[model samples]
Target: MNTLYRKSLPGTKLDYFDTRAAIEDLQPGSYAKLPYTSRVLAEQLVRRCDPETLTDSLKQLIEFKRELDFPWYPARVVCHDILGQTALVDLAGLRDAIAEQGGDPSKVNPVVPTQLIVDHSLAVEAAGFDPDAFEKNRAIEDRRNDDRFHFIEWCKTAFDNVDVIPAGNGIMHQINLEKMSPVIQARDGVAYPDTCVGTDSHTPHVDALGVVAIGVGGLEAETVMLGLPSMMRLPDIIGVKLIGKRQPGITATDIVLAITEFLRNQKVVSAYLEFFGEGAKNLTIGDRATISNMTPEFGASAGMFYIDEQTIDYLKLTGREPEQVALVEQYAKLTGLWADDLENVEYERVLEFDLSTVVRNMAGPSNPHRRLPTSALNERGIAGDDMLAAAKAEEADGLMPDGAVIIAAITSCTNTSNPRNVVAAGLIAKKANELGLGRKPWVKTSFAPGSKVAKLYLEEAGLLSEMEQLGFGIVGYACTTCNGMSGALDPVIQQEIIDRDL
Candidate 1:
């Protein structure tokens, strides 16, 4: 019997089952209609469920039943430096606690493979225009993070089933999307899909590959890391239909900023956003990656695009060996995971976003959903001769300006996944330098690519020198400014702002 059963406390109704039999025994051809996420859940349930009550539990998803609790076993855990460091710290504390009791401290280790990438620690202390900006900024990072780094290094040898990808490597999400996650994982004589829970809110960036990656809070990741199942009900799956081609020069960042605003307005929080239609099909995996990477910024749990030729193309482009790529293609096709296979897939709710309508945009001040059009900068009071004059006057007086651009950085997996944005920033920097439009002296700028590949491409394009000329040098490959580790401001500038409250 390929069934599993469990009994919970009174009033609790979580009976777990494996999906293998559910797919075969439920309505014929129903498994193909399930989302990739559901398929993964099914695989885990079948493998781990006890033999007594499998079908009863499988009937819940297969029949759209919603009243039961199911166990989901993610294949692994991925984490960024800030949260990952904190997580390990907690575990160390737990280890001490466990040792105090009769429990063995060494016995407390991650049950599944866990990868902790050291990113999110550097901050831009120098503008991109400085010739020694990269070296200077790195020095500051090492000094500031000595405490965190010491603890992290200890974690390397102290924990079992945990791997540390050292800092100055790249952003965690980009590294995972590019090099870490094998679309399919083979272990212990069994082959299964690769699904994971990451500490940051943007862990879903790798979802572009049809993986069921979701970002969870550090607290939640701790639970999963300790071998507890993430219990939750079925999410509202929302289909976002994209249409029309983007206008020339429109970056994926621009589109995602706009889409993020639109989708949030449409209320997609905690929903699974499935990008479909012609616009999605036309998008390169890089562009798709840019969108999926912002899944958290848009308040969705996962932003998934169907696996298709583009997905295959990206695996090859990123230099994955042929055999692995072949396995991905073969498995996806055989398992009905291809884009064409999901054409008839149904969703409870759907919305539309037009790629053609998107324009160059930036998000922030305080929120990722706050999309700001560059054209509206003057009208929106973020740009204007008056503000510029005030800023210049403050500079003349040796005072920091109101609304000064304190940090202008190129960081985060959201924007870093696309080479276009990186190249664009470099090109703009080059043009600005040629035009004598240097960054305000108060602005701290840095460039931290998520992978070494970006450096190669930028150098090949001859834009690295231009970036350095503007003081946007590589500040060690890491998440840097995006994770709130924007390095210290110039002491003088910081004092001026503090003294004057500017």
Candidate 2:
């Protein structure tokens, strides 16, 4: 530890590295211009890097120089089963090599904290309409992946600094957001901001809580697991100023879909975007997470918001201990990390967005960034007007429409993690139920929230059954449709596939 910058944090017993003072010591008033991402990165360098190279490395950030690569020591590595399994299998191979070379195989272990979540492999074999879908699907998962599960469990016991949340828990990203990230991590009587590299691209989901979590490839995850510095250049830290409130009836999904289109068009590929202004402040943590979860869809590395009261509020809401929560707030304010402290942060480029301009939207016809208005999804747009008229006429004669929707899945961690979005969906279902309108007989639908707690909340709100009434019952709390694990299609649709030989 560099004692020159090490100082006792007030209101807590833990010591924290004074990143602001160190940055200012070299360039007065420059710390104030550093974006949130830069501040977090600088803190880690001050706390972890060699004193000899500290000044030169920080100067790289201070001057926006990308000529040479710096080092990033992420605090943790997070992984879902697919990529995590591949990385662990490699480690197992290395252990064998070590034993053959007369080295202690048991000594080989991850140097940094690592988490592996067994979430992605589950397929929804049991229909959501069945009340026992979750249990049944989980049983099927265990039966099919019996050998795979055995290995994952053995690795958890065999490896040091490794923790695993087994299958049927929840999506890895959601678990990270809800409970894993401390916001401010304390170790060895020292406190610092939490940062992580995940094996899945959507790891930025937890960036909603103001942590600098980003996704990396399988090899990068393994490197971080070994406590090696992830070599890097400073990303194009772009500032996004959200200026207006969301219009009435507009959902977080709508806002994200619009922003995804805008950011993609702005060519913010691989940039670190720091969202600020009144509009960002107004959003709840869940809503911010909804946007952050879709970071890759915008071709961005991370979507970050400054730590503020909203972050603290979310910690409390998610059942974080009060003392730790207070520590997070105090540390952020003292370290210039609070949203209020970053009024004058500078960015290489700034993008302007107005939330009120967004309408109810969805991605369609092709890619996730391909934004399409829901209003335009009707007959006059996708299908020809004359054909739609004929289809409607045919439907009136007690026949199925020519282009009826077969699947209406309410899925993805991107939207379902946001309470506001789910509540709005539930409310719509309630109203539709009251109106005596039900799901079409041929429509196969499911609702898969990223968190298991979603069921409790929806039941308390009396909306689960209403959703079930509309054929949108709870499926397994895992990434299904989005991960290509959507199991068997409806039987009717399957038979149609067979008869289509006509």
Question: lDDT of each model, Cα atoms only?
Answer: 0.79, 0.89
What's the lDDT for residue 379 in model 2? Answer: 41
**Candidate 2: regions farther than 4 A off:** 383-389, 392-400
TM-score to native of every candidate shown = 0.89, 0.96
| Candidate 1 residue-wise lDDT, 282-387, digit = tens | 9987899899998877788999887789888988988888877876776566556678877766677779888999988978857989999999989989899998
lDDT of 2 by residue, 292-388 (tens): 9989999999999999989999999999999999999999999999998999998999999999899888785358888888787664366567777
Top candidate, metric TM-score = 2
The alpha-carbon lDDT assigned to residue 469 of candidate 2 equals 85
